[model samples]
Target: MNFSLKRSLTFTIILGIFASCSTSTEEPWSIEGKSDQEVMAIADSLAKTFIMVDGHVDLPYRMNIKGFMITKTVEDVSVETTGNFDFPKSKRGGLDAPFMSIYIPAGYQETGGAKNFADSLIDMVSRLPVTFPTMFAMANTPADIEVNFDQGLISLPMGMENGAPIEDDINNVKYFFDRGIRYITLTHSKDNQISDSSYDTLNTWNGISPFGEQVIAEMNKWGIMVDISHVTDSAAFDALRLTKAPVIASHSSCRRFTPEFERNMPDTLIYALAENGGVIHINFGSTFLSKESRDKFDKMREDLTNYRAENGLSSDDSVYTAYANQYAIDNDVYEDVQKVADHIDHVVSLVGIDYVAFGSDYDGVGDSLPKGLKDVSTYPNLLNELLKRGYTPKEIEKICYKNTFRVWRKVQEVAQGLQ
Candidate 1:
C-alpha cells in the first residue's frame, strides 16, 4: 500500500477514536444544563420517555366518595377534575402506571362488611377500561404496564390498602390476586386480625398475628407484593424477616425526617428493606415530608378530638367535620416540593437510588400535598429537583419505575418458585 493511503487510514482511525472519547466524556442530560429551565426540559423529556409507576394512588376511593359513577362513562378522566389525578394530568406528568388504591377505611375492620367493600372498590377500578377503553386499562403485572406504555394507555393496577377484606380466609389472597390486586397493606390506621398499625395504640399482635404471618407467606406464594406502609415498626420488621420475596413500603416516607412519626420507615428499616432488595416509595404529602407540618396536624387532630368529646359529638358529626375543615384552612400548612426530593435524597444517600421510588399519596392526602406536586401533572417538577441535586437520567429512571419493577418481577419469580 502507498504511504499516503496508509496515512489517510490512520488519520480516519484517530479521528474516530477522538469522536468516541468525546461522546463518552460528555455529561448526561441531567447534568448538561446552563439554567434551571434547561434542566427542567431535560427532566420533562426523561419523564415522558421513562415509565413512571407510582406505588399508590387513591383515585378509586376518592371518586367513590364523590359519587363519581365508575361503571358509566359520564365524564372522562382525560379531562380535568377537582382531584389530584386524572388522565390528562397524568399524561402531562408522564405517569404511565399508577396503582389504584382500593383503600378500605379502618372503620371497616369492625363493620363486618370489609370484603364486600373491597370488592366494590375493585369493581370500580375494573370498570375503568370499560368506561374509557382508549385512555386506560387494567394491569396485573409488570409486563402489563410495559404493554400499556407501548400502547399509549395508562395502566390502573390495584392495591388493597387494608387486609381486613381478606376476612380470615387465606384463600382471599388468591381471590384478590385473581381480581388484579397486586399488593396488600395488611392493615390501615388501626390494628386488625392481620397486623398492628402504626397509628393504633393497641399492640394487639405485637408485630403480626399468627394469621398475618400466613397472609405474608400466601402473598409470596401468590406473587402479591406485601406492603408495609402503615404497619407498626414491629410488624414491618416481622414482614421483612418472613417474606421470601422483597416487600415494598408502597406509600411511606423516611421517618428519619419526622422523628416520632411511625407511619414513615425509620433508617434501620429503610436499610433493611434495601438489603432485602426492596424499595421505599416516597409519599408526597406535606405532613409526611415535614416534621413541623406533621406536628401541627397532630395537634389539630388532638384539639378536634377534645372538642368532639366535650360537645358529646361523634366523629361523623357535621359540626365536627366543619370545624376540622375550617381549622385546616385557617392553618394552611404545607411543605415545599424540595422536601419531597429531600426524602429521596435521604434514601439515596443511605442506600443508593435503586431502593427509592415515588408513591405520592395523591387524592388521599387531601389538601396537604407538597407545593409543586399538588396533582398528577407535577412529577416533572420533582424530577427537576432531583436533577438539580445531581441525579443522573439513569438514576432518575430507576427511581421513577425500574426499581419498583425489579421488586415486582422478583415477587413474581418467588411465586413461580413456590408453585
Candidate 2:
C-alpha cells in the first residue's frame, strides 16, 4: 500500500504544456449528429498525442467466472464471452494503459470471501504474463505504464473495486498491496465492515464505518489510492475529509446528468473532490449518465426482483448484474461516449480541466455504454467527439491520462509525508 513510486512522464510533460495552451472552450464533437467514421477519425487524431488511459475495467471477472485466459485475445463481447479488453482493440483505440480491476463480489463479505476472491484475482493477474506474455504486463505505477508502453506492452495496474476482501482486518490490506492492488474502494452496493456503499440497502455506519476510517489510514500509509466511487455520499465526504492524499473516483459520473443514482457523485462533492486535488473519471454507463436511462434500468431491476422472488431465487450482485446486463441488451440502452465528454466538460467547467479523467467501467457494466463506445477500442470515438467539441490536443491529453497521473503523484507526496 506504499504509494511511493517513480515520477510519471506525463506528469512532467503536461505541467509545462498546460502553461502555454489556451483555456478556451467550444464544442468539438458533433452532439446533434455525426458519422461513426468521422468520429473515429477525430479520435485517431487526438489519440496520437494522448496516452489514452482507461481508469477502470473488470477484466478479472472474465478470468474468475467465464475462465478467460489473460493471454488470449478476445475480439467481441457476447453473453458467453468474458474478455472485453484485448491487445488488438487497445492498439486500435490508441489506449496506453488500463487500470484493471480485481473486484470482489459482495457475496465474499461473509466467511472467507474476501481472502478467496483476492487470492483468485491475484492468480488471475499472475497468469496474465504466463498466458498472454506478449499482450499483458503488471504495472505498479504510472511510470511503469509508460515504460511498458515504450516496450509495446499493455500495462495493467491492479485496483480492487470493493473493500469486501479486507473484512475489517487491517493487515489484510497489506496483503492486497503485496498482490499489486494500488487502490481499494471502501464499499460496494451494500455496506460491509469497511464502510457504507452508495448502492447498499443497509446504511451500516450510516455513512463511514469505524473500520472504514482505519482502512483509509492504512491505505494512506500504504499509498493505495482511495477510490470514492461506489461509496455512500457520507462515506465519500468522510473519506475525502480523512485522507491526506488526493483520491480518484475511478469510475463515477455527475449526479446532475443522472440524478438520484447513488453511483453518480453530486456536483457539490465533485467540486469538493476537485478542491481537495482529487480526480473524477467519467463513467461510460448510460444509467450513470441519463436520468431516463437510469429509471428504465431501475424498473427492469424491480421487475427482475419480483420475478426472482416469486421463483424463490435470492438476489445477489451476479443475479442483479445479469438482469441489468440482459435488460440493457433487450432495451438497447447505450450511453453515447460523447456524453462522457460532456461529463469531462462539466468537471472542467467546475474545477478546470485538471480534475477529470476517463474511467470506462468496461465489462463491469454490460452493454450500457454510450453509443459508439461499445468496448475497449471504442474510446477513440469518444476522443474524436471531444475534438469536434473543441477540446485541444493538450486538453484532451490531460483528460485522457495526465490528470490521473498528477493526482497519483500528489497522493504519493502525501503518502511520503505520512511516512
Candidate 3:
C-alpha cells in the first residue's frame, strides 16, 4: 500500500485544526443494592432511562437472505417471533438506535452486483418507518437519534458491512453517505478492492491497498465512520493510522478472552484504537465472548464437516441440522450474560470507561449467542450483570450510548472541516 507523503502532510494539517470530541463521563445517579430481583428491576428501568446505541445490527441482511421484506407488519422483526430482535423486544430492552447493517457477503466480491445488493438492503431498512410510522425512523445523525428517542420511536441507522459496494469509485463513498450510510467496514470475510480481511489468508493488500487508503481518506472526508472489525491486524493498523477521525469495530469483542480469534481486538490494537478515540462494541455471541466456546464451536464445525462428507449429506439436510444441534447440546459451548460484562470490563481496563459500548450482532450471529443474552430483550440482563460488577448508573449509560455518539458527532465534525 502506498503511504504517500502528500496525503500524510494534508492529513496532519487537517487533524491539527479539527476539534477533539467530548466523551462525557457524567453519572446521573448512583446505585446500591443487594437483592437479585432489585438489581434486575433497576436494570430494566435503566435501559429505559438511557439512549442506547448498538454500533451494528444485521437485520436488513438477515431479512434479505430469508426473502423477508419489511412492511407495515413483519412477524419476526416487527412483532416478537423467533429472531434475536423485534420491535416489541427492542422497546422492552430500551434499545434506541440499532445501526442496521447493510451486509455484503464475500461471494459478491467475486461477482459484480455488490452495489445493487447493498442498495436493496438499504431500501429494506428505509421502508421500516414508512410502513410503521409510529415505530421507526431512519437516523442520519446523533441529533436524529435523540429526537427519535424522545418520541418513543426506534432509530434505524445504516452502516454498510463491506466496501465492495463502493467498488473502485471514491465518489461512491459520498453516494452512500447521501443514502444515509454513516459508516462502512472496509472489507468483510474476504479482501476485496479495499483492505485485507482477518478471515482471508491471502492478505491481498498487505495492509490497506492503495485504493483502500483512498477509501479511508474519502470516508473521513465524507463523515462515514470506518469500521475495522473484519480487517487483518496490518490492515487495522493501517486504517487506524490513516484515518483522520475515530473508527468503530462495530461488533467485535476483546481478543484477551478469545486469544485464538483474529476477528477480535488484542490488547495492543485496542490501546491504539482507544487512543485514537474509537470505541470497540462487544459482540454478544458465545464464540466471541469465550475462548472455550470458540474451541468447542470450532471442533463442532470440523466434526460436522467430516460427518457431512462421510454421509454425502447436503448442506440443507435435516439430519445435518440435528447433528449440529446435538453437538451443541453435548459440548455445552455457550457462555452466559456475565461473559459480555467480562468483555466490557476488559475494554474498560485497557482503555477507560469512555471507549466501550454494545454492538450485539443480534440476528446475524444465529443460535450461537450467549445463554442469558440470546436476544434483544436480554440487554437488561447484561445490564444487571454490569450493575452487579459495581458499574455506576452513569458509567452504564456511557456504555449504552454516549461513547458512540461522541464518535458519531466527531466524525461528522471532521467531515465538515474536510469539506
Candidate 4:
C-alpha cells in the first residue's frame, strides 16, 4: 500500500520470524537452588515470552457442531467462554499458533459427504480472520504464524483430522493444500480408503492403501505434513516409509504409559519419527497420560460395553446411556498436569527435546483433560513442573514452539525440492 505502512509491515514480519525461530537471548538462568515461587515466575514469564504452537486444536469442528455462523460474532470464542480455547484464554496462555483441526468424522465416509463437510469446516476457519481480523489471522505457514505472533494476533492454521475428505480423488490433495490444510491425519476411528485406523480391528487396507500411497506422495509434493495420529501402526509405518518429508503425530501420547492403548505411539514409532526428523506433539488428554487414569476410566467403559452386550442393549439405548453417563461421573480420576509433563518427559527420554512439542487435544478431548491443563490458560503450570525438573529456558522454548517450527520449515523445504 503506502511506503511507511509497507516498511512497518515488513519490519513486523521480520521481527516475528526471528522470535519464532530463535530462543531468548536473556542471560540463561539455573534451577539448582531456586524456590518453587521463583521457578513458577520464570515459567510465567517464559510462557508470555515464547511463541507457543499447539499442533492440534479442534476449534473449527467444535464450532461447526454448534452451528456457529461466520456472519455472527461468536462471543463464546471471541471473548471468555467455557470452552477450552477462547481468544482471551489463548492469549493468556501465550498460545500464538494453534492448528485448528477440520475433523471429518468416520461416519462421513459412509455418508458420502466427507469432502463437502470438510469444506464447510474450512469455511468456518476461513471466516475467523474475516470476523476478527485484529485478534486472529489465517496462517498457512510458519512465517505466517511468526508474523501474526509479532502483531499480537493468534494464528489459526489448519489441519484435517482425517483423510476422508480426499474421498476417492487424489487431486483433492492440492485442492486442500490450496485451502490451507498443512497436515492430514490419514484416518480416524475406522480404516478409510487412505489408511487403516488404529481403532479399527478390520485393518482394511492392511496399511496405506494403493491410493493412500499416492495421497502421501501428492501431499509431500504440495508441502503437507503427513500426520499419523490415529492411523494403525502398519499405516503409520507405511506413511513413514513413503513420505518424502518428515511427519507429525499431531495429537498422540506415548504408549509406554498406557501399554494397552494402540492410539498412543510406542517406542518404535517415536524412534522412527525422530529418525525422519519429525516431531511427536504430546496430547494432554487424561486417558493419554497414565495407566492409572486408563484403568479407572477405560475399564469403566469396557464394563459398560460388556453390560450392554449381556443385556442385549443397543449403545444408544436409554438404559445403557444412563448407565454409561453415571459410570463416567462416578470414576473421575483426571490424571493431573504432572502426567502431561511425564508424557513429554517420556518422549524426550526416547528421542531428545527436539522431537517433542504440544498438541493438546483441547475442545477435542472433552472433559478428560488433566487437572492443571484443563484449558488453554494453564500452560504455565506444565512449564513450572518442567522447570522444576530442570528444563532450561532454551529447552522450554523448543517445547513451546521451536521444535514444531523446525519440522514445519523442514517439511516445506522438502516440498520445495520435490516441486
- Assess every candidate by TM-score: 0.87, 0.82, 0.89, 0.86
Lowest-lDDT window of 10 residues in candidate 2? 1-10
Instruction: Give one digit per residue, the lDDT tens place, for model 2 in 120-230.
Output: 877877777666666667888888887776666788888898888887578988788888888887777778887888887778797787878888988888779999999
Off by over 4 Å in 1: 1-33, 69-78, 298-332
Which digits, one per residue and each the tens of the lDDT, describe model 4 over residues 102-154?
A: 99999999989999999999998888788878778999998888778778888
- The Cα local distance difference test for each model comes to 0.87, 0.77, 0.86, 0.86
Residue 336, candidate 4: Cα error in Å is 0.8
Candidate 3 — which residues are off by over 4 angstroms? 1-33, 67-78, 305-323
Q: Best-fitting candidate, measured by TM-score?
A: 3
Put down candidate 1 lDDT per residue, 49-149, tens digits, no spaces.
78899999999898788844344454545457788888889999999999999999989888789999999988888877888888888999888988788
Give the range where candidate 4 is weakest over 10 consecutive residues by summed lDDT: 14-23
TM-score of 4: 0.86
- Give residue 140's lDDT in candidate 4 (0 to 100): 93
lDDT of 3 by residue, 1-419 (tens): 22134324543442232212113335223333246786687687777777889988889977776644354353345455567766888988888899999999999989889999999999989988887778889999999988787677899999999999998888999999999999999999998999999999998879899998999999999999999999999999999999999999999999989886899999999999999999999988899988899888888888989999999997689998888888888889888898899999989987899999999999889889888887787789988899778687668879999999999999999999999
Candidate 1, lDDT over the whole model = 0.87
Model 1 clash pairs are none
